[model samples]
Target: MDDYQRLVVAQFFESLPNLSPELCHQFVLRHIVPALLPKTTSKVDVQPSAFQGSMSYTAILHIHSTHGGHRIVVQFRTEKQDLSGVTEASCIHGSIVPLVTYQGMYEELFVYTSPFAEGTPYISVLTSSDDFELPLWKKMAIVMDLADLVTRGARANNVPPDTAIVELTTTLDKTQHAVNDYAFQNISVRTSISACVSYVLSQLHNIVTLPLTLTHQDLSPFNYLIDLSTGNVKAVLDWDGALYLPVGSNFHFLDSLFGFMTLKGWQDADDRHELEAAFYDRALDSLAAQGYKGITKEKLELQKAIGMLLYGVERLLKSKDEHSEHYLDGYLRGLSFMKEPISSSY
Candidate 1:
């Protein structure tokens, strides 16, 4: 491991005084190393990841075998937050494998029992994205390509009926409950807006029965690796959130919207609108090519608006701090669009 990586791991352990270093080392040797390496492997390097905002402890492992050397990222989650069910579902539903070989997406290498006897319960190893720098436009292209590939692949391959998709209705219902239960700082006005947004989304869900497809529910630009030099997408990361959803879910689009909004600040409305228009045009064309004929400009706008409102509500509900009112601004903006008739042409 590099000096920086060692320091990070040491700091992590230092923060947890009760945990023994020897036990942690043995845990890695016993469980992680074996699952990721060959018996003939002579050397291994483990380094703590520098990524932020993840709920799991992450590290990158370099393994050297007789054949060659390769790198893998390992993530460990607490028993209470164990992702075994999600991983198992991906495997059983045949979503993970095809994403790598058939769809040209990245591979989720392995999932194993965590070596930490307490607190942590499961560990997952996945292929690394190799960290290629990319510009905003390039990232947008990659997101569009991923959406197209997954939608087409789902239509071609008969995806099995999974409980995740079947439970989406229940999930939407819970989302409505979250909105109603949200203790807004301005409870009177915000609650009225929240209820209206929730009702609109529920109505859309009832009226539009779009064909389901494999969707990366969380499709932010950070979850992908793009080679800025060639404008090519090297890998699509983080399949833990992948599931079967409406073909034009717009999760990626919303991600791109909010991402650019943060980077450019909320004041640059023109550029944001331009990017949204371009993304929607490309998405509509791609879906049409895949024999999805029902999506008109009006329907596309409605879907995109609903996607924005849904994510905004989720953000507000998940926020634990007093900053929820700040998030409510986004929800209110989305609701305004839902109330008016949006232009079919961006």
Candidate 2:
């Protein structure tokens, strides 16, 4: 490592007394910097990454090279077991290769040696998306186009592998376990929420029997890059949580829209509901064109509700770790959605 990088590592070690300085420095030189900029001899600046609130070991660096400069975000794990799953997910770029060819979406992947002290293996580096301000309509259009592409591409290209299904079921089981273990102040409320989730999962079994697709399980607004001038999505970020799961996993799109509308100061709940319904209608029509069947307004609503519950419970589980009140609020809001009855007709 260079003088600047060494100094940074020394500072980091000072703050993290449990970590070894020699090992951390070795990780920076051998794995982190090289992964940040491959095959470069140019002067690069390494700073703390702008991305925050992540559970893993993360570093966002601004790199200056001979050609130009760009930002690189990195996530690593200290333990071998914790590193394996993320490493495997990072390497699975092939699943979304077709979708990246479509307009309004982009994907790039970089794999390098693992930064861990032992059991070192390959890890991934991805291009961080740019932040651009755009009109609400324009942003929604970009998101809809991306959702369509991901859904259709999975349909036309390949069937979901057995391993993918196994992973999905495993995650669902974990969510169930988390729900059962939830430490709510009211035992009756917790029981009711757990029962609701169970009912939804039972209903979802039939839906899972249908074809599966590569889905951006986390589709928040912050995960996308948009060209403000044209309002087109230039890139999509954070594929580590992506999965080959059942289609209509675009609930994150709605979650993002809710947040966006709130941020934009939309006061009327009816207006937000209209926008969401319109987006769902457009999405359903697009998927239909690609030969996806069995989608109805009621089913779509149920899917979104189940998705919200899963997301909330997952966040609730994490709140125990991060002690964030925001996660607790999200979990309660998700439970409220779970209480709604899934009707057959809209």
Candidate 2 residue lDDT tens string, 47-100: 433332233233444556676766544444332222332333434433322121
TM-score of each: 0.63, 0.57
Give candidate 2 regions above 4 Å deviation: 1-15, 18-41, 56-135, 156-181, 186-195, 198-206, 228-231, 250-253, 260-270, 318-346
- Itemize residue pairs with steric clashes in candidate 1: none
Score candidate 2 by TM-score against the native: 0.57
What tens digits encode model 1's per-residue C-alpha lDDT throughout 126-215?
A: 112222223456545654555454455334324333543345546566766766776666565365555544554444633255555666
- Count backbone overlaps in model 1: 0
Q: For each candidate, what is the lDDT?
A: 0.47, 0.47
The number of the candidate with the highest TM-score is 1
lDDT of model 2 at residue 160?
47
lDDT, candidate 1, residue 130? Answer: 23
